[model samples]
Target chain A: MSEFSVELRDVVKKFPTPEGGEVFAVNHVTMQIKNGEFFSMLGPSGCGKTTSLRTIAGFEWPTSGEIYIEGEPMGHRPPYLRPVNTVFQSYALFPHMSVAENVAFGLEMEKTPKQEIKRRVGEALEMVKLTGMERRNPTQLSGGQRQRVALARSLVKRPKVLLLDEPLGALDLKLRKEMQLELKALQQEVGITFVYVTHDQEEALTMSDRIAVMDGGVVLQVGKPVEIYERPNCRFVADFIGETNFLDGEVRAIDGDRVTVYIPRLKDELVGTKASPVRIGEQVVVSLRPEKTRIIENKAKMGNCFSGKVLNIAYIGSDTRVFVDLGGVSLKVWEQNKISTLDPEAYYERGEQVWVVVMPENALVLHLG
Target chain B: MNPHRRSPLVVVSTALVYFFLYMPIVVLFLFAFNSSKTNILFEGFITQVGPTEIVSGNVIQSPCGPFHWFCELAKNVEVRNATRNTLTIALISTLTSTIIGTFAAIALQRYKFKLRTFSEVSLYIPIVIPEIVMGIGILVLFSQLFTLLNSALSLIGDSQLTLGLTTVIVSHIAFSVPFVALVVRARLHGFDQSIEEAAMDLGANELVTFWRVTLPTIMPGVLSGALLAFTLSLDDFVITFFTTGPGASTLPIYVYGLLRRIVTPQVNALSAVWILIIFVAVFLTQRLQSRQAY
Candidate 1:
């Protein structure tokens, strides 16, 4: 078998608009998911994440390209012929069937022995923590239980690759968080390649081993969660993945890996690392995370320190988010509340003059799409 | 006045509406047991038989006690034949129309083709047009087609084709198909297409997925549609009147003919039996549907 469990080679999917114009739902996208890897495609709605997952699952055929599952080329193969199953966002359980029956349906399709089907279905339900819900209908279960049933139904098939289209999207916040961790654990236990699609960046980051951030039918970056968050290659990825402050600038000087950008608003130069090569004099945006920037009293020791007035301070439990205005550009700085104190004077006050310092490595110079 | 309590006027109006709707049926059922042959007067219940009496120059007897008219209705060969014809036509038309209409609904709802819009819009035509017009149209079409076929067949031999139970059943199916299709289509509207995808993803092919997932999911709608078709066939009068041939008279046509000749308590007995059958059928269906609800 190939090292990659699933691969899409320049897959393009086009759908016709009601007005007779064609729109590319997935545009020239290529991705390789490694074996037993938890891979997630993260994007906003209509960003082709779900479309890419569907193509990999063989629910849809690419207009021009090919998909390979476990080294086998899938060309116009229907979903039933592919050894992949999907956990739909709606959980798409067979409402008429009981939980055990729903999980056994795949085995029955494979013509497995009845005893084996029953044992496998029981094990699958137990894996999803729904062992006792065997005889209950899908409509009788809660949303999260129904989601688990959907997971068991798909996982029971022992597919080479499992595609999840926002399986936890319908759950409440706490349940979604719990399921995210549970799904990551389940993927590890089953040793099946998981191709998850979600619009929620936090969920994707928490569950996926590697994430592909996409926008407008294109993948902007694919990397580990830390790499994606720390060194985003484009403005969309930086903005989409997490909260980041964008500083508009033009490239001034280029080093081997470091680049200097001149911000017209601040009338100062900011140095940051560049992942993709940037030409001198090219316009780019520097993405700086709020948590990476520090609010300090001493500015003499800092290299990229700017004295600014605090515009707003929001005291969230673990961190204090302070918005600092450096001339016309407003930057957010997150200060960790390490010391437990309820005193009002312990926190930075609004309109107070403070120095915001960002390390050179923390600022990411991204190409303006 | 209490906000939850209904006003006196509301209660009276509701009672009046129900009374208006069921009064005639109730009277007909009550008259089924009446001993009077004329049925214009409320004769006392004469369960005990005395000596044979002559009323209005005709001999009247209550051989079957209070169920005299029902027994007479059961004995009438013409009514029995009509009842058999009605049931056969209804059952056949219901089954055929249900299968055809379900296919039509699925095709219209799930597939896109060149004439999809036209087919969908035309499904409502049969339902919207007057039944009498449909009856007349079917009659004319059948007459013309049978004439053409008979003349062609005469060239070879003396084989012939004429309207009978076949024609009645065909007409019933024609009108019933649209209602069934519409009802089934309404059920299909709320169905999630992703369930079918899920089934296929689980290694079932198109046929298996349809049989296992799609059919079971939409079965309630199909059953309700079938029930509607069956009742429509059973209750149809205008279309049956025009489409039927000799010796193929249904219950409603037979009742109409009986009314034309003379009104008897046997008609009331037949109607009372019909009301009971319909009520039982509706009750059973309702119970089945509730039990099937998840």
Candidate 2:
């Protein structure tokens, strides 16, 4: 059992649709989660991130391909034999069971002695900081407390891995953030591999050791949280992970990792780092994050810059989102609160000429389609 | 007219229509304690005033008899045996049908297969078909087998074939399985499937998941369905009438036989008792259903 926590080799899951054909829920996807590592599958709804998690939990069986947990091939081995548990999105605590009973259930299944079961249940409850809630049913607990009970239930088993599918998604924003930190700390303290699934980009970014950005039943990229944010490999990944200004283009030149592409929308040539191979004259897409794109009052010659009219602008307290209309398309620039207040009226007005500047290296270009 | 007012004629008509719907049941229930011999008030056309007696707990005897409820019912050995038979058949049918049909419900809920829809539809066939037809069909089939091969068939021939307590129970079970299946099915549908999955993830095999999680959660449904099946079996006359050969008779069938001989005041008393028993049964069933909404 001492092996990588999980390994999925080309797993594909399809669900039967009512009108005849099946929907390819989880397309051919291969991923590995190291032992004791915190990994997350990040995506939009219906993107198969949750399905992948379910397959690992044995709630779903792949149409083809294999799933291995701790080096044992899971060939229709019902969930019970796989030393893994899931904290469901709804916190799926047994509504009829008290918090302590829920936590003690796994131990009781193991036929552990009563004294040890009670002691470990107490320990598990305390681990989640939910002491004295042993007898309270799930309804009596707040959303966060219920989530803790779910965590405690699985954690008491000390499974090889803990799979949490959107565990914090049901909580309010403040509670969600607090639980995110708690989950990370808990994972560290327990030292068990955790495979978390969530559609919240910021949640994945803040909590995961490694994040797999998925779209349309495919994993677009997988890397450390910072790597996914700072160097998104594709347009979908860039758009899904954070705010980005997309520009359609054709590859004008390719020289190793540095490529020059002409963006037809802005009628300009911009330099960007290439993540994948691209042929010359191929229709490609370039993504510049809103924060990376600078707005200057005067023309800047050192970086890629274009002058355009500010079609609209919105002040969001902490940042100003300025929409600069460049004829065929518009680009967004998030000016920090301090920088935005420096010239408030000049940007928020309509039809005001503005300079949209982008650092050459900060722009990310890729062949997403 | 004020706002939200209906016409005066419409209100009067509605009240008259409601009275028509309830007038008979109200009459029967009120006169269950009527102190007069006549089904209605005494033929003298006098409406008695009882600000005292039954309505207030004074010692006035009921109309049908001396509130002789227990001995009134126990005087006839035939009625007593019929009561015993009815209770026996209902209990047996409810227990057997609930166990078998709940397993069937579990299969339908847990697995996916071709021809599942066909099997599901077939489960309701017994319920939709005429009960009288089903009972008579079984009776005819069994009687022919018993006559043609009296010595050859032995397992059920001893008692079930002779149309006594055994035949009644078997017939009841046949008519009840489908209703049990349907209610258990709806309960299974509304069930949160994750309970089974959770059990498995916590180191339970298929059998364990079923025993530990699925069965306990679905118990209320099975129980309520069993009670319904029992009540239906108790009230069934047409089906029991056809299936019973010479000896087997349920309470309703016994009442029918009594009506043929004489509509004894005791029969009315028995009818009131039967209605009272079923009333409690229905009340408890409804309570069970409401408590299981979650």
Candidate 3:
């Protein structure tokens, strides 16, 4: 009924605290997830990301405001009446049922014909790469296999949207990563809108078409992974998305799209592009990603460059993380190790003098509040 | 410590504990076949060799009639009546309590309402409060209610109400519900609420979700609770004694009456059979529960 697959309009969900005070779990959260887009709500625990997803799944009814799915208002409708299915974080595969039976449950609930249910269940199991395991009970399956059964169970319904609440969270690290790609590929193949909820930033960034970074029952930023990571709108979004070196400063001057930030720690005026309109007297934080800043043996000819002593050098397989102390403040910089040699001479030594060079276009001017 | 080698102290203590637990039941089973009417001691190791009876000592007059005792018990009218009454009350009460208590447990576990905590705590009252107090309370309640009913009936005709098997069953159900509820509640504690949600989200209604998902998940606990209720009802004497009328005596009450009259080996035979039934039921319940735990 709506252009967007799902929309929440100023939804606020209040939960009673143990002390009897009411706290908003989802406070005035407004967002529209497009049709067939992989939209993720990413945040730390207790930040209302799961609540927002649950609201969309119709598991939670907002205390105030309204929710719409496919242009239709969901007014006190139970989850059974809603046209969406969820793969729960715990897998939630029916332990008593076989994989095929679990997958066919939604179809059976809809009163689908016996032939169609069987055909569709078979197809669904095939889609999840679990064709031969149909007769096996969920309890006999491994964590990843159970997760796939849950996926197949929900996906067989062919609902308007599929909700995944940290479906890969229980798996081991390698399996989680593998499933992350498989889930993205499966979503694209099915062409159904997905509302994925997770606190893992890398997971959100790796698969989502767009991400909504939530904190304190609020949606702080909603944008593509690149836009959210590179040009975060506020301090929390910038820091939470990835490893960012925050330079607290005052806005000294604004020239066109370029703004000069006066940092007392570096005793230097760093120039970067502003994400929003800023006044000269406003306090700003320059969000510089660790990977964006390069450690140079010599001073660069262009951009913001500062000389500092290397505080720590850590070799983390793929890259070398160098922390440099620039007078009063230290900046973390990640440099990819391009060479394959293990020679000691190739690595940067601690306490070595180096220049921290940040590209002006790479630095983002974020609002203090 | 090596896995195979247990310390002597541990082995001795374990053996002592087993002896303390099972010695009485073993003695009861042994004396069920006693040749004499009294069951205090064995009658000089009397032995039966096929048709001809062989005796080790001349002090005994008859052989230990193991099969004869069971045969006499089966023929005894009171024992048969008690057995029938015990089984009937146990089955009816177990069914009633399991159904009512499962619903109560689900409502308490899944929903929040006014007086919810009070209701939850009230369930424990029947379980933890001494059975003697419960028996007296039920007896007083029934007598007062019976008097009130009879007075109302006096308008039409004069009739007196008397406690019977129905009263016994009702009282058994009253105590059985709490034990059932406690067990089902423990099962529900580990139940993943999301599985129910997933069922509903998959378009199954609440009733269907309960039958398809919730019931099957907690079936082991419900069965075990029912078995426990059945055994409790079968072995119950306190409440049954207080509530039962003259002709409605259950097996335990009948056994108590027999013991007061005389310590016949027939009573031991009945007890041995009762103990066997209870052991089988309890063993089956434990097996069912342990299977579900995995």
Q: Highest DockQ: give the candidate number.
A: 1
Question: What does the TM-score come to for chain B in model 3?
Answer: 0.90
Q: Write the per-residue lDDT of candidate 1 for residues B103-162, one digit (tens) a residue.
A: 999999988788888998898898989888999999999999998988876734334688
From the highest DockQ down, the ranking of the candidates is 1, 3, 2
**lDDT tens digits by residue: candidate 2, B1-294:** 587888889999999999998686565555444444434342221134333233332224433334543444677888888888888888898999899888888788778889888988898898888877887798797788766666565455344446567777787887888888888888888688876778788887878777877877888888878987888888888778777766677888887877787554456677777778888888987897677555
DockQ of all candidate complexes: 0.88, 0.54, 0.76
How would the candidate models be sorted by TM-score, starting from the highest?
A: 1, 3, 2
Best by lDDT: 1
Per-residue accuracy of model 3 over A1-369 as CA lDDT, tens digit each: 568999999999999887979999999999999999999999999999999888878888999989999989997899999988999999888887888999999999999999999999999999999989989978889999999999999999999999999988899999999999999999999999999999999999999999999999999999999988877888899889899898988999889889999988888989988976688988989988899888889988875898899999899999999989987688899999999997998889998998988877877887887
Off by more than 4 A, model 1? A343-345, B49-60, B155-158
TM-score of chain A, model 2?
Answer: 0.96
The better candidate by TM-score, 1 or 2, is 1
User: How many clashing pairs in candidate 2?
Assistant: 2
What TM-score does the predicted chain A of each candidate obtain versus native chain A?
A: 0.98, 0.96, 0.97
Clash count, candidate 3: 4
In model 1, state the lDDT of residue A143: 98
Q: Candidate 1 chain A — worst ten consecutive residues by lDDT sum?
A: A297-306
Shares of reference contacts reproduced by the candidates, in order, are 0.93, 0.64, 0.91
lDDT of 2 at B45: 19
Misplaced by over 4 Å in model 3 are A299-303, A339-347, B1-3, B38-66, B112-114, B155-159, B290-293
lDDT of each: 0.90, 0.82, 0.88
